[model samples]
Target chain A: MVLAFKNETFRDDFTFSNSPAAIRRFPFPFVEDKYMYSVNIEPHELGPKGSVYEFPIDIDEHYVSEMRDRALVLDADPGRCQALPHMITAQWDMLELLMTSMARDYPEHFSLTRDGNQWHWINRPLGIDHKFTFGDVATLPYQPMEYIGRQCQGDFSIQDQRDGQLWMDAGIITTQADWSLDFDVGMNFFEWHAPVPLAHQAGVFDRALKFLLNMQHGRPVRRLNWTMTINSRLDTSPENYHKWGIDRTTVTPENVGDKVHLRVELQALWRLPRSNAILFSIRCYMIKMRELATVPKWGRRLPRVLRTLPDEIADYKGLTRYRQTTIDWLSKYDDGAPTSLGGGPD
Target chain B: MSTIKSRPIYPGLSPDPNARRNVVVCDAAGAEAVVELLARADGEFAGRTSVVLSSEGLFGKESESIVERLKPATVETTAGLVPAIDRLKEILASATMGLRLYAAGSEPLIGSVVQAGAENFIDPLSVRTEHRGSLKRRVQCVHCKGMTENVTTNPVKCAQCGLLLLVRDHYSKRLAAFQGVCINAETPDESPELKVEFQ
Candidate 1:
């Protein structure tokens, strides 16, 4: 079996499975039990009607039972092990489908993770292939990377919606065009959504380059002192991408009585490693949307909120635990792509 | 000269003559978006035409960076580069890191020439109107809204009015005014594509 074959999944289709065996292979999209939380929400006009549901397991229990039947402390069959490539490919494929479905199914609730909070988001079609290096090497400091003017090959996926996902086959030292942010980064989804307007930049990925200027008031917006550090090592800070873009949009006084929303996205690059150290394309997004998104106490609970029907727990034994959350947003939907980061509340 | 317009729907104790020009402390996102909204409305609806995006302090450096990235035209000064209108000025400016969730609800100040929601900012024709009304009416107090009888001296007590007559010191009031650096629209994000090579 090949270690890294390019195509993530067999089909381009978002819905339906090939066949339903007493045991199935691909499962429906879901969140982990450890991460799920109860939220009180009032849906917008275009909100979804879905109840809460946990993420599904792609493996079948019958197979696990079969291995156990072999005895001797559970047979020669590797319980969760499959062809390594098959698992990787399946995960990537399913993630893409899930991202698109989430956008299509729930547009209003679509978001990206920003400023340490969560929100809703939709989907965007992506580029074929590219690869990149981890910015923060334990041994490297105060030194510009030698791979600045280089190229690699891999598919790119950026999903900033509430349930966005990203998967890429990458190499060390390459750059990406698509930007995204607002979600957690794990083995499954590496990059989040890219912020609007700032998606495209003009320089090399400076470890600490200046981004988004003029954050203060009453001065000529100047362009110096924009040094910053972008972290890309999955093992170290696998929660996100190194490079990103942001836009601070607003409601003008002319519009009068409107809320402000900031659209943002995070980006990263990855290369599968050849050493004992595993190559990780890792990260996720989380946003506050605190002001924009209210964890408000509503007058009454609607029958259908952001809830999933409760299900019986499968065994949690031997499961490697992940302990983090992420979020990010779309550029446009109700309005045109965020035209510009204009100022003031109308 | 910009304008100030206040539209407070709720009644208040300090609502008495609240139409004074002032500044607001907007967090990162607040300064950028809020200023744009305020400027646009002041220019379009309130006739505070051409109010600019001015800045000062640490905001200028980054603002300048963004000004260069988004509206590069604002940076040049050769004829075509010259702004037809003026905007607010700042000291420092930079770019947003694509994840500025920290600035959501902070409202900065919008210093207009008039109230936040005034019918007019500066009656450009007012000078002429006052010219027709004579020197006595030209030197009226902006705050007290009364004519300065002596035009030059502060009236301790006036025969025509009971209260002390106030006069505007145009020279002192207009000095140290924050000016705009985006004399022209310059930042153009045509593309910021970074080249990546595989190792």
Candidate 2:
């Protein structure tokens, strides 16, 4: 059957539409001309609300399209989503957490009917009504987390909290912004983020780790991170570097405006009530430079940040090749708009 | 997109600047000239908030009817005579500050315009709309996933497939339309109900 609304067409048509939903919900990251990375984490409620992933688990307009993309990614690379054999409890915890969250947020479309050990979960959006007993893997067709993740829009991973640190152990991640789930699995929280520049030297990671460790069960924390991509491709992981990596260098100056995309990942970390595992959800969004330029301030600020950005950070971000050209294109709309252009003493 | 950037810019903390709040409204009849209206405000328009009003176009008119009426001047006023969506997009991309967008029109018109801003990541707080026109909707057929604009009936005919569809409250933001499910989905031989006024 033909899908009702294919995402590619929707994006192509809406990207240029003034005030299209895609441009409005886009999280423009640069606030000033000078650029630097720090522990930018914040409480989930404090950040701009209702733009993305409002609840612990959010189902948005892109839910169906993203889910379809995930399925394709999984089919192409089984290594994209995996759960260690010993992490079954965490998987079950995530499954329950996701179900309850969905049922609470979209009650009309999702419901969880429970009677003691037996429970019935209905996903109206997916048209799936499942009945299973709690804690019984056999009752479900697939692993609890995997089964639930198949329908989720965000990539999820669980970290076991112990020994004064959280260990990255289990997850179902098909759409990673950059890092690899297979490579980072089993690495401690700090180690997983080790590749991220400046966070460690600046003590941002230590402070964030402490904050994450002390996170209360009911409270969830989230933060927004952003970068630029060469194209609209969502699967920007290194695993398929050959597929998209070449585009980075080959894109000419004329097409750079339309080809370059701003990628923002909204990452939320939750302290699962039981099993003491932290569920991290990452949802990615991309808007090209031409569309992003519509936001006058965004168009202006982005280039200044890039032009003044140090080479190290630029290299780290894979922006070294096109940073200048991207800056030139964004500068067309800049008109020397008022901005903070120089870096301050750290 | 993953990049490792290493630049020791200002090593220290800097105060985060507040984004300039902008207001843009789109409707069948765009609001009055923004500059003149702001000139009449208690104080001057000191560039704190940029305002642009994109109203629907008038057929056979050489100049935008609203722009001609307002004859607005200054950076704060734009008599956007083209499709509000096109003008709004142009306004949104050029600003250097954060924006707050407002739309006033029919449900379908407002929803479609708002969906554009939502897609661009405009903060929900920064965006609001007052429904000012008809109660009709823009429906999307679930069976064919095609959008039918300006629908007025509950059991509307799907423009794409000619199927009788019962419109549901479920609005898909992606399609920016209420789902119109096939009325005879379960019963293949039964004649579907013809028409009913939408709420």
Candidate 3:
């Protein structure tokens, strides 16, 4: 079914909000009351009809607006989307994966017709219908990855697997939580995640890297990562942190419900068929504190997750300034009840 | 916790006897490390070695005195680290098989050599590094993307954008510098006291 794409802004006035349907499918990351680092991964298989995992490439109400914000970010800093010279083959692999998945899942909104090397793609929401030679970069308006990545909802990265490591060779990362793809473009999996506390000591990367290295062509894996943002701002990137960081101070007891947002990332990884590379898609979903409290389980669990959150992690996530305010606001919805087994709305 | 994994570590220089050629790049303070490294080397090492020294910083006189004692086949002295790196790049371009690369002195010097080696198809981790002299850093401002060299303070002011940046240990080998983010972005007026942590 076609989604009612929202005409919202992620910046300036910050008009972004989630509908009731959208909030129900929100990927609430905390499964239990307390949270800690883990290699929490699962197969990227189809889930129940209305869940975010219903499709390989999820397109929601925010798709149009998110894509627009991505364009604005790229316009301001072209460095946000980058691919090394060697990632050309992987770029085509990414285009094929996204196009086929999106078209198959949401046939109403997207269509892809392939006639050998010549391919025709129509994105109804964005109002684009283009025909191009599949493997040729000259036939497309932009590079293969950028052309398709701009159309997709999430931040996409392609990792070149070599020397028993995944290299962050290419990505379009406009909506990253705090990391900079420009700074981390060529870093290996371990190197790029160096800043994260406790996880390294926990051998999380070692196990995760081993798992990813052995990932096969048809199989894809998924995980959930989260961070908090002051507003419903999509570009919480370090590149523009100076502009948005001050929003942390704006949060108070009164405005916490409207101001604070829980940003969750549905990170999915696929092993590309052609390039032997991995396609890492990070789909960001943001819901305000007030909207999230509508779901009783989420409202209760989020506060517990925040209150008992490790000091190191809390600092690392940049929640030191406004965590107490957000927790105190969210606490009103919590009756100190135990959450259910999984991260689903009760 | 202060040591980040991405930040390159100096394992101290050791002579590679199996190498057909040896290229040693260093700054003024690194001359002692070179001397210490050469003390353990065999006589044949001196014959095959080419040394690039930059006597520009505070330890210049000490570096010269130490350089005088070296008996390598060739010694090339430059005005500073930038020129020394340029000379290293020239050598790397013409480098043949069985070449061993070693870098010493300030982190910037070592990082530049490693970066240049990486651009020339040499693995950065393969380059031997030894830290010496000033602990000052070379920071890249995340805002303006400017490279501020010789940053000594924790909340150092960006050389280009003038933003007070928190010098994070999170480093980038490709850029050969540490990441500097705006420290006072949340509360612009309240400035934190600058600490000379790096030096």
Best by TM-score: 3
List ranges where model 2 is wrong by over 4 Å: A1-6, A9-19, A46-50, A339-346, B1-199
The digit string of per-residue lDDT tens for model 1 on A8-58 reads: 211122111122221121111122212121211111122112211111111
DockQ (model 3, Cα): 0.84
Chain A TM-scores of all predicted models: 0.17, 0.88, 0.99
Ordering by DockQ: 3, 1, 2
Docking class of 2: incorrect
DockQ score for model 1 = 0.01
Candidate 2 chain A lDDT trough over 10 residues, lowest sum: A9-18
Clash count for each candidate, listed in order shown: 175, 50, 0
Name the better of 2 and 3 by DockQ: 3
Task: Put down candidate 3 lDDT per residue, B70-188, tens digits, no spaces.
Answer: 66646788889889999999999898999999999899999899999999999998999999988988999998999999999999999999999999889899999999999999889
DockQ of each: 0.01, 0.01, 0.84
Model 1 residue A267 CA deviation (Å) reads 14
TM-score per candidate, chains pooled: 0.17, 0.58, 0.98
Position A42, candidate 1: lDDT: 18
In model 3, the Cα lDDT at residue A326 comes to 90
